[model samples]
Target: MPLLKVLRPTLPILVGASIMLTLGMGLRQSLGIFLQPLTRDIGISVSDFTLAVAVQNLAWGFLQPMAGALTVRYGFRPVMMIGSVFNVIGLALMAMAHGLTSIIIGGGILIGIALACTASAIAMSVSARAVPATVRSTVLGMVSAAGSLGSLLAAPIGQVLSEDYGWRAGLAGFVVLSILMIPAAWYAGRVDRVPLPKTSGDEIGNTSAGVAVKAAFSNASFLVMTCAYMVCGMQLVFLTTHLPSYLAICGMDPMLSAQTLGVIGGFNVLGSLFFGWAGGRWNKLMLLGMIYVSRSLILAWYFMLPPTPASTLLFGALMGFLWLGVGPLVAGAVAEMFGLRWQAMIQGLAFMSHQLGSFLGAYGGGLIYDALGSYTMAWRIGVALGLAFGIIQIAFALIRPLSPPPVLKAA
Candidate 1:
């Protein structure tokens, strides 16, 4: 099995997508490390910072479908290149911010839009288009695994720099990293040159975006998956946005948050590989349900106990193993349902649901903490919602297995 021979043609695209994904997601996820310093220095509340993050998610979600559709009209290269530039500008603004308006514009609006073009959805779509269907899921998993390394590197670098210098310096460090996205996006744009693979007559590969979106919304399984995806966003974003503050409240060292994030990134590689492989063999929606269930249980267990280095690290490892695995599963499932032509857009539609949940997780958690001065209520709600959604996802998957929606030829 000469894997290299098979992948050689598309290797550059995959590599570029992976690097873009790593830095884009990594740097964004690590922003929580700056919350304390940024808020205190700017004389803003925790809720303010979280609000910007929430807006970022909202912007990312709302613009994703548009970005994906543009990829269909234009090529991925141009859309992604523009996004890479946005990432640079956004980070630069954050690094120089003296007020909330700047943070909202840079961190919330621009970076949010940047992610629409550079993060998981776009990255996964690039990989899917670059490879054969036979190996698409595995390759998606591999790329996702590789992309997970960004947080591992970003967290420690930002945390160290911020601790020694200032929050702005940490963001400046991220700006340097984001510049690399320009070249990565250019290379990944090469996938635009690879003609879309042929699909069955029944698949909606040639449908207009309007028609395809209608068909996607009409499907029951996709709807269920999209709803469950919201819970996924809620749970994951809550952690990334608030976990450092939680640790700080617990009197843990600031460095622990970065280390924990690094651990999660390390484990993301394994989770992506495992779930990517599992998705090809098992039911993707069911796998998603199980991951959510496991995450809720872990959340319950971790937050219930006092924070220790060992326990915190363990939580990071466990949680990390479950993180980003969704990239391959969701991406693969979208491709299976809609075909590659609109996979990015359809996935973006689902991601809109996920981002709505992210808005809740990031902002809602902050609001609760501000009011109560404890995260007890927030985590409780998250766990309850996660368990309910996970069960629903698993049950719905078992009852109504996924099938592609009908596509009518353009009249």
Candidate 2:
């Protein structure tokens, strides 16, 4: 008897998608470690660093919808290749940066654009298409968790690289990694962008890119998700960018700060997996609301409690639980309402809102600290935003879906 071959179509897509997430998220998150060294060399205040990061985030936000459009006109492989190119250029420029302005151009603008083009939303959209509809949330969660693995390890690895070599060498190291992505992206080209069966529905939508944008803008649900994501961006970027510095300010050792960040990253993987499980078993909207509420409550409690190593670690753990886990839920929501065919474009547009919030969170926290002589005001503001997110998501959940708008058959 001849050996039988078993078909396993989803496996390649999963592997390709996961690799993209790990590299994209891991490298972007590690940029935070360069903040101090870059500032000292440039002779700029921390605020300058903050502003540059903020602008970088803003660039990511502004470019997202456009990239999504490109993904529509082009295909996943092409867009991802463009992203990899930008990543290499941005990191090289940043590594060789001299002045404050140059760093902004390198670290803020280029890197931000690169991340928007190739990161979580783009990769997970592809992963979403590769799986069964019922497994959508789980697949998205796995993707987020994969990225978190990068986030989890980035701090320690970045620290070690910076120590063994130097900050410049560390930056150079990632630039090399970005080069590797070029090949990975090219290989990803082998996977079909447009689904097989070449049936009418395989295409993402018949609605033109402009029409889809207009429809998404018109949808109240989309608006609510966008607004809620702003808070998500703010909270996430602020914590990730400044948490190490903040720990230092609190009189903790740098090693301890690195450890805290690592733990936060580790916890995020668990958080994403657990929430994804809940997303499949429960009402996704409600789960989203609860995540926000939990964040708000945790921030409030952290503020009320005295600062201690034990307290900080506990807070970091809780924050980790709510971290990128939101990615899968939010991305899943986009796929749920819209179609996965245009998943990258739609999610990119949504993420633009997120990066805008990130701009605010990252730079705003620095401004708050510099102005107030402490981070008190910033922490308080985070609590307020958390509450706001909860409210927005809850209100969105109450609104009825618009009769599942005509599923424009993709040709």
Top lDDT model: 1
lDDT of 2 by residue, 352-393 (tens): 888888988899999997887777888789889889788778
**Clash number for model 1?**
0
Model 2: CA > 4 A from native: 1-7, 193-204, 399-403, 406-411
Cα RMSDs, all models: 1.4, 3.6
Please give the distance, in angstroms, between residue 217's alpha carbon in candidate 2 and its true position after superposition.
1.8
Best by TM-score: 1
Cα-based lDDT at residue 125, candidate 2: 72
- For each candidate in turn, the TM-score is 0.98, 0.90
Clashes of 2: 0
What Cα-based lDDT does every candidate model obtain? 0.93, 0.74
C-alpha lDDT of candidate 2 relative to the true structure: 0.74
How displaced is residue 330 in candidate 1, in Å?
Answer: 0.6
